[model samples]
Structure formats: C-alpha cells, structure tokens
Target: MGLGWIRRRTGHRAAKNQPGDLDMEALIPDHFLCPISLDLMKDPVTLSSGITYDRQSIDTWLEGGNFTCPVTNQVLRSFDQIPNHSLRKMIQEWCTENKRYGIERVPTPRVPVMPNEVSEILFSLAGSARNLDHQGCFECVRRIKNWAAESERNKRCILENGAASVLSAAFDSFAGDCGKKNAIVCEELLSALSWMLPAFDEESHKYLGSKASLHCMVWFLKETDDLSVKQNSLLALKQLLSCDDHTKHAEALAEIGGVNDILFKLIREKISPAITKASLMVVFYLISSSSSAGEKIKLSFLEMGLVSVLLEMLVDSERGVSERALAVIDSLCDCDEGREKAYADALTIPVLVKKILRISEMATEHSISAIWKLCKCASRQEERVLVEALQVGTFQKLLLVLQVRCGDDHTKEKTNELLKLLNPYRAGLECIESVDFKSIRRSF
Candidate 1:
C-alpha cells in the first residue's frame, strides 16, 4: 500500500513539473506575434527605434521617422537595447539544433520560460557547484568516470540521456572555491568528448534520434572562458575529426573560430596568459582536425594575425599550448594555399626552420611532428635550412626520438625520404653509424 501510494505521488509530481510538449506556445504572445495570422515566427522583422518586436506591423511602419510601438505605440529609437526573452530561447534552440541535426523547428526547453527564468536557472544551478562537499565531489566524478569506462551502453546512456544533469553536476563542482579544476571539469570535459566521437561506421544520435549534447557544450563555453572549458573545447574538436559528418564537424569548427574573438575580447581590457595560451591551443587543434574547413576560418585567422598569434604561443611556458600551436601551423600549411605562400612570400620559412630546429633540440615531440609536417610543404630555401640544421646536430635528437615512439620502419623511411628531399647534397649521407642503420633499412 505504501509503495503504490509513493509511486503514484512521484508520477503525479513528475507530470506536474514538466509541462506538455505543446505548452511552449503559451510563452509567446498574441499582440506581440507576427502580423501574419497563422504561423510561428520565421523571420521576425524589426522596428527603427532598434526595437526588435515580434508579431507587430514592422513593414508598414518602417516608412516614417515617427515610429510607435506595435503593441502600445511607444516611441522607438534604439535597436541595441531591445530585449526579447522568447526570441532568445527560440534562437538558442535554433542554433543548438542546427548544430546537431540539419535545420529544424527550434526547441524550447519548457516553452515560454522568460529570459530571466533561464538566467535564474543557470545562475542558481551554477552556484550549486560551489557547495559540492569535497568527498562528494570526488566520488561523483569517480562514478561518472567508471561508468564511462565500463560499457558502451552505459557510457552512451549517461552521456546522451543525462548529459544535462551531468553538466549541471559538473558546473556545481566547477566553482573555483573547490580547487579541483583539472579533474572536476577540465579533464572530464576532455574525456567526455570521446563519447561524442562518431565511430567509423556510426553517426551519433540521441534517444530521440537527435542530439542535444551540443547545447550542453555551448553552455559551458559561454558560461566560462576558463582554461578547463577551453581545453575541453579543444579536446572535443580533436575527437570530432573522427566523425564522418563533415557538416557536424564544420559546425563544431565554428565554435573554435569564435575563440579568436574570445581571446581578443580579453586582450582589449587586460591580457591573460592562461587564456592566451588556451586560445592558441584551441586554434591549433581546430585547424588541424578540420583541415577542409578553409573558407570558414580564413577571415578570423587573418583578422586576428592567426599565424603570428600561433608563433607567439611557442614562447608560452605552458608546453601544451605551444604544442597545439605547432599543430595549427601544420594544419594550416596543409589546407590554406595562402598560408603556404605566406610562409614563402612573406619570408617566414627561415623563422619556421629556426623554431623547428629549436624544438627538435628541446626534444618536444609534438613540436617535432608539427615541424616535420610543415617541412613537407616548404620551399627549397626552407628545406636548405632544415637540412643544414639537421647536419649541425638536429638529426641525432630526431633519430633518438625516432627510436622512441614514431620509430617504426615506415616513419623512419619517410623521415629519410624527407631528408633527401631537403638536401640532395652529400651532407645527407648517413656517415655516422652503429645504431643498426642497415638493420633498420633492411626492415624497411
């Protein structure tokens, strides 16, 4: 008797808490609605006073300077100050859906919640992150991580079904007051990204045959420009490359493009070293993973000195950012024809070679790989510099590195091939010996 009553009460409460799917319409207004009698908003027109009112006579009234509010004939003047909470939620849903499936009807989480309502929910929920008991924080994340590792079904169910709640939980833990930034948010965001990665033959879909995880991503990205969020964004792009859907990958790429703006906004007031570093790293990963997304990224990079910006990242003390910046160079040279020319026509090759040689000297594997890829796309003079640098002692470190991880016979052969291309002269000779050169050659 007790269990039945509890279940009935819970069911009733759940039904009450979540409105029916059609309830979003009530959040809209009749007088504010578009003048077109019977349709949902598609292209909402604007007033001259900068009022972006809906369902009003915008077209008829645009002829004269004296504009009256559509609803109450109020005076109009500034478009910038207009605030439409319903429109925001509608567009928010629009962009989120466009991110996943193709264009579709905008979703309203619970139709007609005012803009203040969303703000309140987000702020209040975000504030909860401040209160995660130390032990509770660790245990919750541990459980999530363990679920991620246990089974594919488990991973997908948690990520796809509970992504919102999980993020809400993550947000609560994100408060700086707790101090477990890396594991709580940064590392977890990076790790959760692997789930969204589409398999070779599978495209991701939610239980409804759609995806909302992106909404969760946008929330985090917009909520905090923290290094963890930026890092997670980068890691997510890196994994997104595995997705066969170019359109989806392109959409994800767009967010990275916005990062440049995010960085400059910081620079406008006061520069942040961590932000600068994270920003460059994200650019690098994005460009590398989405080589084909050329036109979309070109303007942002050029407007932002995308090349020089990355060159600066090399000097950043955070090795991770510097490494990712190197990655950006490799990716750009591969995709953007203009960038390849910029290296030659702009006379940047010597600088690139110098950086490569220095990175090789420092034993930075990521830099070496990036530098090597760039080497493939350089002109003869750049090759000369690379060859000369190798002759002076760069090759020893590279050879040693070759023995470590990328040392298989194929990579070694490729390296040798590149070396010969860089310099046809006798300096390319393997004059030094004793490390199984012939044996390695034989394997090749």
Candidate 2:
C-alpha cells in the first residue's frame, strides 16, 4: 500500500516465469489486464469518475492508517473503499458459490461435472479484466473449485502414468486459483471422505487412495504451509494412517523428502514463528505418520542435529523451537521396536533433557504440554537415568516449569509423584499418600 513498497517493474516476463514462478497467463487474464499493475487491478483507481479511489484517502478515512496507491497517486484509508466494481463482483460471486458448496454439503443432489472446456474457460476468465466483475469473478472461482476437485481425483492416475506436463499444469493452476488457494477446501474434502470411507466400495478407494493422489496429498501438506492447510492435512493423514491408504506412506514420505532442503533453509535461516509452527507440525506428520517416516525424520534430525539448534532457539528472546522438538521426540517414542531402541540407545536422554530445560524458558502452554508428554514416556529405568542426569540442575527446571506450565491437576499430581521419586524421599510416604492404599497395605 505504501509507495516505498512498490518497485519500478524490472525483469522481463520470461525471467519472472522461469520454471518456479507463477505464469503470466495463470497470474491474470491478458485482456484488459494492466501490464503495470499485475494482480492488484489497474488504475484510474475507481470504477467510476469524479470521486476517484484514493488509497491513502481511504486508509485515512477509515482512520486505521494511510497508504498511497502504487499505480495512481491516490490515497487509500482502507481496502473496503477501493472502488473496484469488477473485483467486487468477482468476490461476491465467489461468496455465493461458497454458499452453494455449503448447501450441497447439507444434502443437495449431486451436480454433473462441468466440461473440461468450461474449466479452461473459467481459468482464462480468472486471468482477465472480467475478473473484476463481482458475479463473473465469483463464477470464475466456482468453476475453479469444481475443476480442482475433478483434477485432484485424476492427479494420482496421471502421476502413476508419469504424465509430468499435465500434472505440473494442474498443480500450478490449482495453486493460482483462489478457490483452491486456502485450506478450507482440503478440510472439507477430508471431512467428506471420512463419512464415505467406512462404506467405500473398492472403486472409490482406488480413486481416492491412488498412489498418485496420496502423493498429491503429501505435496499439499508440505508445500502449502497455510495453518489451516497444515492442520487439515495432518487430520487427513491421521485418518489415512489407520487405513490401507498408508501402504504408500513410505513413498509419500520420500516425495516429502524432496522438499526438506526448503525446510532446512527455513529452520536455519529466518522464518516467522507462525510459519515455523506449521513447519513443525508437518515435520511431526512426517515422523509420526508411519515407522518409515520416523526413520526419515530421525535421520534428518541427526543430520541437522536440530535438537541443539532447537535448544538454542528455545532460549531465543524472540522465538523458540520447543514445540517442534517435542513433536520429533514424540514420534521417536512411537516408532517400531528397532527404531525405538535406536532412539533410546542414541537420543532419548539428550533430546528429553533439552526439552525439559526449555520448559523454563517458554511462557506458552505448548512447552508445558511437551514436558508432561516426556514424563509420561520415560520408563522407571529411564526415569532413574533422567534423575541422575538432573542432579546438576534438571529437577529444579521441571519444578519451575510445573509451577507455571501445568495444564491440569492430574498432570501436576503426576509431576509431584515423579519428583518425590527423584528426591531424597522417604519411600513409604508416596504409598501412604496414594489415592489407593493398596500399595501401602501390600508394603505393610
């Protein structure tokens, strides 16, 4: 919104669209599309004349703040008053179609799938000046969603056949289309699938759980990174974990591995805490979703020695990595016996100790939850080791954490019981104080 935020457009269109970026045709419609404004819509600023759209004026009028339009020298006080009728029409249309989807969810008859040409037309329309027409924009969004749903069903088949061009185009178009842009669609899709799953005929399973489609699910889970997307993807994957759908979990995990270089950059380099939280959840999915995935996450964790870095981040004045670390540890706790043994043999103490230490630094409920989980997992043998490890300062760290972070009375009670074991304690005192006197009576 600020003039300073705008840069004089530089690179050639070819450079901008080289392989990894949004394509021009996919970005917006060519006709009536202003070359200078890109996706924001072109100038004169207002849909009509006389009282023109003023970016800073709108911003100031709203009294939120002020901003200048990038193209026209106009003031905008808020996005609400930017008189773009076409954009409004598109948005209204989108909202209406959304309602239709809601109605269908409530028990409407199934609509016939729209023709492929209609989908192409809708994709093109979304790119054009027609994109500003409220009704037209909304229709464009509707067509995009329907097409995405159909394409998603087809994605796995295409992937298995190795139809790279078709798959890539579908992936790009789906990401560019706003109807498919947010997490809501995935959430709805997974929710509907849950009802249908129990009664799924093999044909339905073949389509929905196809190796290609399952891979796409992983792709969406890892690539999208929106919070809602992250949460729903985990839910869908959790559902899949219980079914035969996870026969491909290892392959899905491998496809996900292709993207960890990006995550490594995100972890070591700067990333916003919100994005970091989702990143950690996705990582947890990678590990906890299957034993094979657990192997992959463990290897990556060791390669990165993420625990040390996460600890350093735990002490960060601004942000910390305690949640992510806890997730990794949780996955380790569940892995198959061989892998679990490797974890206990190699990592159990170091990772848990670091997380316990971090509990003191974090003010969030999440950190406390992580410590409680660690307490639940430690064997009495591991507990003794942990107690020995704590001799330098560990018990105090957990005590301070419990003082603030304990979420429930039961967790606090568990903590007290564990502490009494670790301390210099009278052995019979714990049994005497037990909720059941059976242990004390047996002792007697």
lDDT of 2 by residue, 1-444 (tens): 121111222245534545333222222223223323333232213422224332333333334443544445466444433344554344344334433222111121122233455445435543532233334434444444454465333323222332222222222223233244423333333433432334433344444444444555556555665555544444444444445655455345456445555544555553556445555555555555545655775566556555444445544523334556555544544434323342344344434444443333332233333344454455655554444434434455456547555445654665665565556532332221123122221210
Give the lDDT of residue 261 in candidate 1: 64
Evaluated at residue 400, the lDDT of candidate 1 is: 52
The local lDDT score (0 to 100) that residue 232 gets in candidate 2 is 44
The window of 10 residues in a row where model 1 has the poorest summed lDDT is 1-10
Which clashing pairs does model 1 show? 24-111, 33-55, 34-55, 49-77, 49-78, 50-78, 50-79, 69-73, 69-74, 129-172
Name the candidate that leads on lDDT.
1
lDDT of 2: 0.42
Q: Give candidate 1's error at residue 194 in angstroms.
A: 12
Worst 10 residues of 2 by lDDT: 100-109
lDDT of 1 by residue, 272-314 (tens): 5655544554455444444445455655665566666556445
Count of residue pairs whose backbone atoms collide, per candidate: 10, 30
CA lDDT, candidate 1, residue 345:
38
